[model samples]
Target: MTELRNPVIRGFAPDPSLVRVGDLYYLANSSFEWFPTIPIHRSRDLAHWEYAGHVEGAAPGGSLAGVPDSGGIWAPSLSWDGERFWVVYSIVRSVGTPYFDADTYVSTAPDVSGPWSPPRRVPSHGFDPALHHEEGRLWLLNLQNDHRPGGRRFAGIVATELDRETLTPVGTTHLLLQHDRLVEGPKLLKRNGWYVLVLAEGGTGFEHGVRVARSRNLTGPYELDERPLMTARDDPEWPLQKAGHAELVETPEGEWFLSHLAARPLKTPEGPRCPLGRETAIQAVTWDAEGWPRLRQGNARPTITVEVPDAEPPAFWGAGNCARSPHPPAPDNAPPYYTLRSPAAPSWTDPTSRPGRLRLRGHHGPDSLWSHHLLARRITEHHTEAQVTLQANPTTFTQSAGLLLWYNTAAYYALDLTWAEPEGEAQHGQQWQHTGRTVLALTTRDENETRRAAVQEVDADTPLTLGVTVHRAEAQFWYLTDGTRTPVGPALDFTRLSDDHGTRLRFTGAMAAIHAVDLVDASFTADFTDFRVICTSV
Candidate 1:
């Protein structure tokens, strides 16, 4: 046996749905507003995991345009029906209100990395939907939402039988369970002639946890467990916080394992901030004499390590929180590249425009949800460094390209290369002559205001290399020239780009991104090469 770390898959991977087909285990996580929705990963030993692929065409109309942050795809559940894989998820539009305008959909694929079927709208009670197959019959499970004022947002758990061939409701909806506190994200399994229901309790923040219930009947009353199966709320200082939204899968040898989401926060002067966002974790589980599930660690808190059956590690293992390149050294796995609100289409983003370079045609800026030309990857570790060589000819300030540390539209830090008026000259643009110089500007934005941190004029003929190093709560931007690195901006507060810093509803994590903006005519283009990111636990 070997001890596996708590977060088998790290970074902004939350709402874990685990399933086993044959000897392999496949996991899916929520993508929110990011494109290539519902990323999938696979592992042979539940210790070393690698990126497989995402649910292709999962987004309706192949786009999440104008979807609010943390409001696109939520709590994706993955299941295997002996022949193909089924995924159920909800596209949430409105949040932080009584009306959670949302729609749920289902899709199937023969392989994890697949040509998936077009997503078909299904019966939606609420988000965190799942599909259960028992004796060749399909059942849909979801959180029933009461959107009316003074109504419980999480009303209860509901179930409906669906026709397997067309995925249409076949019977009346049944209310399975309800509780005084918030309960959602339900997964069901059969053990010892009893139907076991697993749920997520509280919210997805510090007070999150997993609860269990059992019933002899398929859609009837369930007995809630005396205590939570997994949580870290009791220990505020524990390394893993917000432990909840879990599912269980049994190995061929009858060993049970639970997959859940947890967050590791940076203890800041004000409070704890989870900049990397909730990640995917696995825990060993055992059934008690009463047929109730419990964590093998013998407590509600999540363990940092778990013992699992021995297996060979993947080729891309590294040190410090198991940190490795987002793009693995091996060429077989897909890199975790994501775009905001839209899929990476040839009309806006092109990798084949130039050899070894990614070319992005500018659209709206980062704040625009309808047309944002941003390409990014998750910031897996607190101590991370990212750099890229940019080639762009920005004739005006409206056209710019840069490296950025982004949390959402309202929170980010950017180092952009654009045309600016010469020192001691009029800041206004002279559109006809373009009387300006190429400059690198560092800007930071939060909910309060947008601030210009610093600026440096540079030669327009040379390709510039921009970089940022994030050490916990602080981020410093710099540029490389003549084999020397020069700081362009003072250390800025990286903690603001976090879920806990803003007052409004925030869910997604920090990302290292490269984006372009041309508010003029959406015709400016930027070429980037040698983009690299390295992350480590500090």
Candidate 2:
């Protein structure tokens, strides 16, 4: 027996689509506006998983330059039909509006890390589109959105058969099921001559849950399940919140398990905050005499630990023995770093320019949608420390570069090396004009306003080490100079960088990043080295 901890895949990995191809299991998760769009992971015993590769060029033209936050890729569904793997997802252009303005596409590859086929546009009924391959025929499942006034945005779940060659609609579109509550992320499987449709009920929030419906025929009036297969909505104090969007895969020995997304919230003064965003979790599944799938424990709530069949402990695991894999690490040539709104192209971001260092040419400010030169990695733990050595000389106020804790354009905190004028004594009735001094500025941005939290003068000639430490909901920024590390700012409210704090629509998780901005000209370049991030579960 293997002890499986909850959140088998940790941090920022949400809306998991799991599939088993023979003995190896492959999983894919959504990458909304970040490049290296769809991240794929592989597991051998279902207890230990490793980062195999990502769906290269998943983003159209290798860029999502102007995509709105949380509005690029939503609920990508991965499947295998004997030969190749297929990925279907929706790219939402407009968020927080009635008109999602979404486009769905499909791409196939012989292997997960592939020379994938160019994404061909598919029929888009709404976001969270999924593909079902049956009897050599492909079907598309999606939510039908009614955009008219007073109409339901989540009108119903619809399925349409697609022509394998042209990838177009062929047969009649069938309405699978409808409910008063929100339902999306439909996954189908056949069991005992019954076609079961697994659904993500409610929105992706505290009220999230997993519900099921089944029909005897491929397309029909489906019967909604009496109870949810799994949820934490009724249990507010449960460690895992917002559990839904699940997919199931059976092992070679016929044991079944479900993969879903859940969030771990930090207890705060006002409320709970989920800084890490939604993560992937697995639950054992079993069928009853009535043929409905239920949790192995016969309970609807999610557990922190589950036992599985046939597994061995890995040589290394994450803090708390949670979800790090023990497989041999990927080659050093390919690092797991992501860039915003664009690919890591040599035009703006180059790694070979400075040999051991990464060179980033300053582009637009962090608030810009077109081109923001940011290199980021997902924050995978509640307690983390990240540091980087930066070599940048910004002579003007318009040029700055530094470390960033980014959630979105509206919410973030940055400790930057920039130019600021210092106060000086002047002659009687005359003002003294002095060159601006290089200063370390800690700034915070939210929906209300952007304000400087602290500032300190620093020597401009020497390379500087900037670091941030986050423990639970609080964060502190620091800098190293002359072999001494000193705190640069007050303890910040890291809880503000969460999906529950603001009123805007946000889906992605927190990220520790290094960025540069040259609002005047895109010529200022910053070289960064010795970038490291260490995270542990609290």
Candidate 3:
């Protein structure tokens, strides 16, 4: 058997479900709110991977409309039952919603590079569904809600046999295992004549862990492991605490390995911080002399390299640079001219007035926010620098236009041009609100916070260029006004914004745009040119 490497895929690729079809290996990861959710990658060897395709086309919208940084896909399990490729995943509007309302669905295709079928919701009332096939019969194992008459606070595992051909449930649903503890992310496997059910428990937080239960019969009184297969308490060096939601696979060479999500905490004295969210890692799995599985490393930290039987292949996924075509290049690396978040009105129009420019019709005030007029691109890497040039005239006192780094409604950073009439200057002199203009704003369920920093603002009539760059791991921000670059704020401790709880700065990935607040019934138009995104690959 050959050894495997750590983090074959990195950065936001969590809740891994791996399947090896012959010599080729495929992996799927969770894409919380990012569109084209469920990123799929293919590898000839476990150590090298390439972006194969996305599970779903665009992010689900309408009744299925994806919520900004909220709705869309979650932990997905991918498998091949010798005939077709199947992917099962959960879709939810919000985290706190009832489980029954959150639906689980499946998509299949003859091949992985697929003209995949539209999602069909499995008749299951849960999230994170895993399908297992055994003895010529198919079965579905998933986490069902604890909504019974007087049940536990969280859900537990439930199973039902399904028709092998139709992929439909065939028998009555049976509760396989129900503990008072919160249990989810169940994967079933048959080993050594015993049906083993592996699951994640303790919620997906610092308390997370992986446990196992076994039963002689497919649906009987199963016995749980005296100890969890993996836990943060067992190994302190593990970069992430609360590591769970695991799937095991064997290489073509017959070596066993486990892939799971691990959180990397912000190295702060205050405690662990996870702004970027959980990332995926792999480790060797070994069975003791007694046939029970043990993680070879004891802890969850992934090794950097591994040895495999097959020769290494050349890199495939992200070698070339992506360019913006069809549209004119943005002037500086500033945000795009217009951006919309679940638009209420049709305010965006591609107009001939500016010749090859997208125009946004400004509405009344910030209260009339949420209209669709924003232009955005995916911000996947940690270090990104962008710039844009804009010409705008504000007629209303509330009218403003500028660059914004947005992650849904809750977290954002913006630099905008606001018009203010001086105290004694009548209605003649208008001041460009420059210093104390940067908006480090966040809106959470509990409170809304905005930290204003000084910036050199460009006046209303002149066309000005603005740019902002984010170096993620180092937590630094650089900005340029009119073409001269300068650092902004004290280097922000960005690691605090990781997805793990603690800091309020939730990293919902990054997007840049230029937008208009309430305009007090006046027309505001901005021409944007030369939009660019630059980054270094992992």
Candidate 4:
């Protein structure tokens, strides 16, 4: 058997929706706020996964500007019905408020990798929507939210018929299941003349888990299973905690597997800190004597390793789980380039402008929700090194371009190469004429407070190399000095970028970015190349 590592798709990849098309398996996950919404990954062995593509035009106007963190696309439900693949998701605008303040949309593609249709708006009953196809009929499943005083946030599971042609609701929505304990992210299927409903129960935290229910009818009372399908909530020492938000799929060999969201929390004095965010994990499943799904025998909770059929590993493997694999190397699935919120502003960013370089025109900076000239990739591992080479000579302090570790507008760290004059002698317009030298600087922003450190000064004529090594909850900056690399600045707290740290809710994790800004005049430009993130376990 081929030993498969858990968290097949790691880092910030939460709320997974799995589907099997022919011999290939394609899965989609929630991409909140960040553009290039609804990232999809494919695999053959269900263990080694690779990035396929994402639902590109899932947002209106190609932008989700002003949407709060964790408030854009949430819990995409990916499914296939004979010819095309269908994806349904919700765009949450207001979080933590009584009202969900969300809009649901649906899109389809002939293949997993786009040519996806522009998203069509549907009813927004709540969040975590799913699309199910059964016996040639289409249905939409979502969790109804109660925003009123003294009402439960997760009211119940609801379902409605949707036209296959237009994706509009056919009739009134019906309540499927109600629970005293929390339940949502409902995925439905049919097996042995029974309609099965799997749900994410409790919250998506340490108390998270998977619950099961079954019914003989499509829309009716669902009897809760005698036992939970899978969970790690009760086991504090479990490596894979927050084991919930799951979907199940069948292999060509008729084997069953469960794809779910889990987190690897580090034991800190303050408590357990999940710096890597919720990740995607898989568990081998089997039907019990009574038809309820159960994890592998002898395993009550999720494990780090699983065994697959002793065959060729999955065709599509992302970054190839080198942390524990004993096999041939797979082509690195380190995301292809980066994604932008707005369409690549031809004036701001263009790959064809400079050969072998991604040139970006500095604009609104990283804090601007509307117009940001930022290009970034998701930080998929906690212990990772993100580095980039920049070719830019900022004549003024207003013009700066460098590497950024971004986690929304408030929390981030950057190593920018910008012009710096001797304190009071530094004038904006006169910077070009002054003796201001180029300096590699470090800046950290926690909440609304910002701190800066001038790491080292260098000649502006030479290209500068900058990088950051992240070890779990701390990040240390590095810069090329003389001929050797040297560390700079204190180890910044990486955990502060998590969803639980900020004043408001933060649904997303950290991302490595490269941005340039010309606050004074948009005259200066920066050329960035060789941007890479190497994932390693320390």
Query: Which candidate's lDDT is highest?
Result: 1
Candidate 4 residue-wise lDDT, 307-407, digit = tens: 77654555433343322211111232222444445545554334355655778888887677667788776666668888888889887788899998888
Better candidate by TM-score, 2 or 4: 2
The lDDT of each candidate is 0.87, 0.85, 0.60, 0.80
TM-scores of all candidate predictions against the true structure: 0.95, 0.95, 0.77, 0.91
By summed lDDT, which 10 consecutive residues of candidate 1 come out lowest? Answer: 325-334
Local accuracy of candidate 3 as per-residue lDDT tens digits, 1-538: 3455454554456678888888888888876655346767777766656666666442334223334344456778998988889888887555544433566777888886686788776766577788887767877887877656675545568888777657687979988988867788888887888887878877776777777788998886788877778768466556555577787777766677777776655455656655445656666777777666777766434444546557466454234222221011223322222233332222243333444454555553332223434565544346666666666765445666666555554455656655544333454433344312222222122115555554443344556566666675453344455567755555554443345433332423345555566444546665666655554444
* Residues 1-538, model 2: lDDT tens digits: 8887888877788899999998888989988988778888887677767776677777778878889988788889999999999999999999989989999999999998888898989989998888888899999999999888999999999999999889989978999899999999999888888889999999999999999999998786899998999999998899999999999899989989999999999999888889888999999999898988899988988887988877553344233222242112235453457778777765433445566687788889988888988888778889988889998998777789999999999899999998777645332321124566788999999977999999889987988999999999989999997778899989999989988888899898898999999987688988888776777876
Best by TM-score: 1
Off by over 4 Å in 3: 1-5, 57-69, 97-100, 148-150, 164-168, 234-237, 298-309, 320-407, 417-447, 459-476, 481-483, 488-496, 501-538
Best-to-worst order by lDDT is 1, 2, 4, 3
Candidate number with the higher TM-score (1 or 3): 1
Worst 10 residues of 3 by lDDT: 320-329
lDDT of 1 by residue, 1-538 (tens): 9888867777888899999998889999999999778888888899888767789899988888888777899999999999999999999998787777889999999997888999999988888999999999999999999988788999999999999989999979999999998999999998889999999999899999999998999897999998999999998899999999999999889999999999999988989999988899999999988888999978888998999988776655434332342223224222346788887655433334466677888888878878888888788888999999999999888999999999988899999998888787877667447578889999888877888889899986878899999999889999998978899889988888888897888888999999999998988989888777788866
Q: Which of candidates 3 and 4 is the stronger one according to lDDT? A: 4
Clashing pairs in 2: none
